[model samples]
Target chain A: MATLGEAKQMILDPAIRDWVLLPIMVVMLLVGVLRHHITVLITGTPKKPQLKAVRESKALMRGSQLRAFRNAIPPHAFASRKAFLTEAYDQGKYLKNPNAPKEGVPAPNPMTDPDMMEGMMEGMKKQVTNMVPQMLIMGWINFFFQGFVVIKLPFPLTLRFKSMLQSGVDTRDMDVTWVSSLSWYFLNLFGLSSVFTLILGDNNGNILYILGLHHYNEPIY
Target chain B: MARLDFEAASLELQQYRQSGERASERVAYLASRIIKDGYSAKLKDDIWPFYEQAVTAALDVGDFRLADECIENLKRRFSSSSRVQRLVGMRYEAEGKLADAQKIYDAILEEDESNILVSKRQIALLKLRGLKSEAISALVTYLDTYYSDAEAWIELCSLYLSVHAYQKAAYCLEELILLQAANPIWHLKYAEIMYTLGDYSLALKQYCRVIDLHEDHLRAMYGIQLCASKILDNGEADGTTEALKELATERILATEVNQCTIDSIKQVVREYLSVA
Candidate 1:
């Protein structure tokens, strides 16, 4: 067995071992040592995790418009459109044929009708109205919450709620929006509680490894 | 014929001199004409002396608009004149077009970086634009490379305070106090920072020092009373409270504290006493 100094020296060597592998090993060792005691210290084993506040509120908004835009694209538009366009746009002329005449037909005008114009106006209004609230909330959240100076929060619950929102959850479900909203609230509560217990699950994959129950762990990827 | 022409010219000049505003307008118009007509030889021989006389007369009467026009015409005639840019910077500053002023100042500084007035105006424009850190850095570099000016130090202190850099603000004020110890504002600001940092006793002492340095420092007097009350409320030691009360009494008797000052001091005193 290597001496403690030798073990530390061996761990630090640039050539002998993979640097990435060492951090991973350190994290695993920390988690195994500390995982059992985290719940006891944080939740005290007797108290059930409170769900009342979690079920009543809306989730904090996260992520950006670009992510949503990419996710919303329909899958079929690419394959069929590409196949049809490739043949028509090829540089080489069509194969030789005897006395062949090309036929031309004009496509119907897209934006010439009154009903279509009305619908377009309505869509534009809806788009603007939707964007206003999103921009306002995002601006407020960015300014107040992300200013260079840290603010003293009046309550820990607000911090917990903010953390839940920052978890990047999409809090909308099928016909009933309440289910998703309740789930978001609970997610925030659980997140804060875990943070209190030193078990925060970060969505950003930042270097802040949640200090485990009794020891340290590498950050969860 | 020559005598009649000379008499008519003298009467016209007299009329222009009698009406200052009219003279400015006439000077600007003639300068514009001379510049536009490429009448350089005529300007040198006759028009320039008349133009120089008009510009000096306009400046004497504080007619900046006419002065600006004259200077612009002069630049139009003498495009290589270095003095024209400095005058333009001053005109922009006087007009309160700070962005334009800054641009002109920057141009002047590029040609002559040691120009004090241009550097000062440029820093002021940076502060107005909310470029606080940049203003601070520029002024610091200017101070480091050249002799210090009291106005520059004061502006630097204000920038530090605006940015909530209390420690740096205190240090800057300390520098100024060393240079001119009688400034009550510096002492007040230093005391305010000390209060914020929970050095209530030290803050009270600083406030007392301000009062000692300037008997009419009502703000510092009020601050001392407030700090004393805070000390009482926090259940701190008795030494600071006795010292503060004594200073307040001294100022109250000496200056015959104005009701406004008394009211404000009482308000702070009440707040601390109630909390205590």
Candidate 2:
């Protein structure tokens, strides 16, 4: 069992704060700002959906609205609408390709579908954009600022956090509150989300944290 | 931002009611210019509503030629669009080719049974052709599918009132009240229906609600007086009813003082006092 002792006061070199802590934070923030602009550039104006798809979706929505608000209309009207929609849905009248195979057939290969391929390409682009900068930042932090205990958090953490908080510093008896430089990078990666949200609106901040976790869990080949 | 400008133009058109012809001409000219200039990439999404309003305004001012041009442009942009097709039907309706208009609407419905715009136009056409029952059924169908449409509910209420279906109209008003409880107009209409149905107590309560929502509503005050007197005549006069009657009279008198319609106010007050 670990016993609580009087707090140990060890001075951190000011150079660690200047070169490692502040630099990591600034770099992360700059990367986030850059990522937001790149995302905006890639997204551009949304392309209009095909008219047939629009009509089909609207038709489905209308059918659902009718089902929900059935009591607002008279019985005769409700009966006619229900019958019409049921027949249409059964016949697949509003389908993009009505002659396509019905239920119980094997699903079409997503690799061969142009729309599916486009979607996959978009996903790949997002993953690449997210992953590359993160890996570079981690590699840079580990190369330049290895094994330095940068700062102590105001709050005490449990022993489980020692491996995480004290990364690149292998001393076993070091307090969990004192984290190494790489852990400080991870802490800033999570903590500066609100500042990013204040700068870039709500949607852009969380993407960086998610990318960080993705790189941590699966090492990029 | 373009939509805001269109709305401002619409408001301006409303304000220039007497010079409607010139205003619509100006609107048509502006719309033509916009269509001619074409939308940049940023403004492409805004073109549809702009053209839609321009076409309607042109139609309103009896400029069939401009309306036709707008429709052609829209059809070129949105080929086989039921909305544009409905506009085509409207042009035929304006040209007094009712059969052709009906055929177009029917064809759109046949192609896309769930086209609510075409359904509404079809109902309006049926009403114009003096097919009241058909219009009512069609409206009921549309309302079932799109019950959130408050304007349609009001239209359905008026249709019922036209056919002397008081209960049905009251039901429509109830739906409207449920949908928009904050809107005093629906409450007033519901109170009016309740008055017609001889439910004086409920009518009085609803009229008081109207007063709560909109102060100094003259019609609701009159409704309160009528309901109070009716309740008194039935010898079911409660304290609340009597207080409501007194409050309504006070509001009416206060309004008369502000508007300087004292003679009419005195006459109404005298009638109410005599009834009491």
Candidate 3:
């Protein structure tokens, strides 16, 4: 439907642009840089793989690779390797603990497995570092800049953007191009990835990849 | 003065330095040569890595003063870095203060269990102090964490071989082969290990693999001939096995030294190959 008399051309205050838009974007950018450094700090050194666990995994890798590249070697050589590996597999020779009771033992809890637990702790640390600042900034923007339409999009959007682009502002008939502070935060959250990649190099600790924030896109999209 | 010849040594070490590779012996040579000739101070700022490399190399060659100077420069720049602290630990090691070095290594590991460099240096210290068994166990633990490290696998193999543990060495070589699938050297070593263990068939297979990878490898050709002759002696000869034995003999003789022809082992190989 066309606009009712094409009337609502809400002009946002220049003060909000100065006070809200620039601050939120700058704060988000700084937080992203800080998060990258924090993740680097948390990963103090490259991890040493546990010998038994590495052997266990590498043994499986070797077997699969041998099978895949069996043609690289002579057939008799492949046969010798296949036979040896098959026998080893049957006897569980490469198992971390071949003598462990297999019949009645329940699977090891992830919490109890120190290696897995350490991995989880590292992941948790990174996620917390990523999410905590994000949440705090979001809450801060919601409290301070709620319903304040801070910036206008350069191009026109459909009426469908009214709910998304004006998250905190409860404007019924305002243009969908007017972005309230909270949606601006959302825009900056996803949009600053290229900035982060430039700063932290190509293999960066990007927020979206670490926390899988794309999950948030389903309802919005 | 050839004693003042930093140019040649620097040129020789340029590739290693550019790639951040370790050439300990040559590094030790060039580093000492520079210090002895009093030319380190003249080096450019682009050679900042020279300090780190020189420090380790100086410590290795027992040039404590040079090590101290370089490490002091590094310490001023990166006072609390784990890598620098590791160099400090090696300095302590060079000074015969094994316990002090061990303490640093332990503390480094306590803070960061992933510092396999420290773990490796500690293992080397153990082996240097003649603690063979301890070194083996330490390396075993290191390998568990860094199983894909081909160098660590090679170290483990040599350690096993040092103790004359042929089977264990063979197992380590197997791991090495898997890790470095394209390297002819590991295959050759595995073949030698299998030969030692009297698994001639497996050894013969590995020898053939080495030959396939390295077409003109003298050692692999010799290995193939020996293993094939052994297999044929035990009456396991098929067509391909006989052909491999003959080919190895031909290649070994075709070489510049004409090994078999000169050494009279050619007659023995011919007789061995000619028997049925």
Candidate 4:
């Protein structure tokens, strides 16, 4: 209901008594923006941990879980013909049934069985063989290529420095004093921190040597 | 001058205490401050902070209705933020008003289908009416349009399993296996189904496969015993009862790798032989 000047005066009086005070808020906002830009530049290289190997190893373990119990629980002597014969002797009895009826016996030569043990062993070999390089590549990529795309950009300060050097500015002119005069020392510090963060910050790298990610008989690096 | 300074500091302290009293009292104080001083240019900065304080106090006291009014008033005078719509949506839903909740969730989803809160609320409403299939369909639809989520796949598979749809369950499991191929449990479950359908020979191979992968797989050991018994009976061309006894004796005398598994296998064998 009041005049616009009265409303304008009401809003500005507490925060800004005069136009001179606006510059302070503007300066703070500019600092915030510069800080944000530097952060983005440093963090642009995304490190994806070598997930494929970890996944492969987990898959192998799961496949193993699904299949068989290779090691016998009772000592072979106890469960085998030798143990039965010993037990019979200890009980003071002759062998009642030497060839007892049984179900689900493995082939006589399980190691030689083409369809069963041999094939599975081969699969295990393949899984282990494949997992190594995948892990190495992932680790190398993460360690080497952390801040990927952002570093490729024409960042303002980097551009300015390139131009300064190109214009025959002495290398000594690039010292802290000259840079400080540009009020960009803090910006550069923030930028470097961000780049390191982008390259090395992911937890996926640990998957490389983790036992569960490797093949059953494969050598892990 | 000392007296004036003392009075001003005391007035500021009193104002702080008065503002902290309650939502109604705080709102009244804010109204009085603006009404008396007219939110003039000289007081604009101070008034904005006071406005924020009053709005926050009202929301803290659960006086959301008044808070909405305050927000609307502020928006009319200033620029509105997307956060206001979010808060308004939450308040409307909290008040047990589904129509309004739906409207807000719809608006949010229209802008961002991946907004977790909007999807969550939307799913909640669909589930409340026992429309689980519809909810699942909606989730599937969302998944198709956006990200592929592993947890969602597992959830959908479990849902299908709960309903006793074995085919769908198998399909879901197969999809998961394709993504994570070495899952042992999936193989076990698939082998179990194959066993139940009387595919004994195939089941035996799976059991053997399991044992090969895991040297101590008790379940696979039990499966092996059953499959071997089936093989001993069926492999004989003459199908003689004598041949069955021969296979049975070989099994009973055979040394087991897992004693506990052998005992279980022994029991299952005895039961099957007795019935046969």
* Native-referenced DockQ of model 2: 0.05
Instruction: Give per-residue CA lDDT, model 3, range B1-276, as digits (tens).
Output: 446566776666666678876667778777767767777677765356777888877776787887898888888988788889999999999999999999999998887776778989999899989999999998997775566778888988899899999977877776666667789998899899889989888889888888788887888888888888888899988988889888887787677245444556666655654562
Superior by DockQ: candidate 1 or candidate 3? 3
Model 1 chain B poorest 10 in a row by lDDT:
B1-10
Pick the TM-score winner. Answer: 3
Assign candidate 4 its CAPRI class. Answer: incorrect
Local accuracy of candidate 1 as per-residue lDDT tens digits, B55-144: 655554556766676676667876754456656665666566777877777777676655666667677777777788999998887654
Between prediction 3 and prediction 4, the one with superior lDDT is 3
Q: What is the lDDT of residue A194 in candidate 2?
A: 84
lDDT of 3 by residue, A1-221 (tens): 24755444566778887999999999998988888887888875657565566678877887887766665544655687899889988998889889877868887778888878878888888778777887799889988987788888999999998877888788787778889888898888888898888777776787455448667444753
Model 2, B53-147: lDDT tens digits are 67777886788877887788789899977788888888888888999999999998887776767778888888999888888998887775566
lDDT of 3 at B193: 86
Q: Per-prediction TM-score of chain B?
A: 0.61, 0.80, 0.84, 0.43
Cα displacement (Å) at residue B62, model 3: 6.1
Give fnat for candidates 1, 2 and onward, in order: 0.00, 0.00, 0.25, 0.00
Ranking by TM-score: 3, 2, 1, 4
Candidate with better TM-score, 1 vs 3: 3
Candidate 4, A26-121: lDDT as tens digits: 343343344344444433233222333333344344234323322211133124434443564455333233353444874366666554674576
TM-score of chain A of 2: 0.82
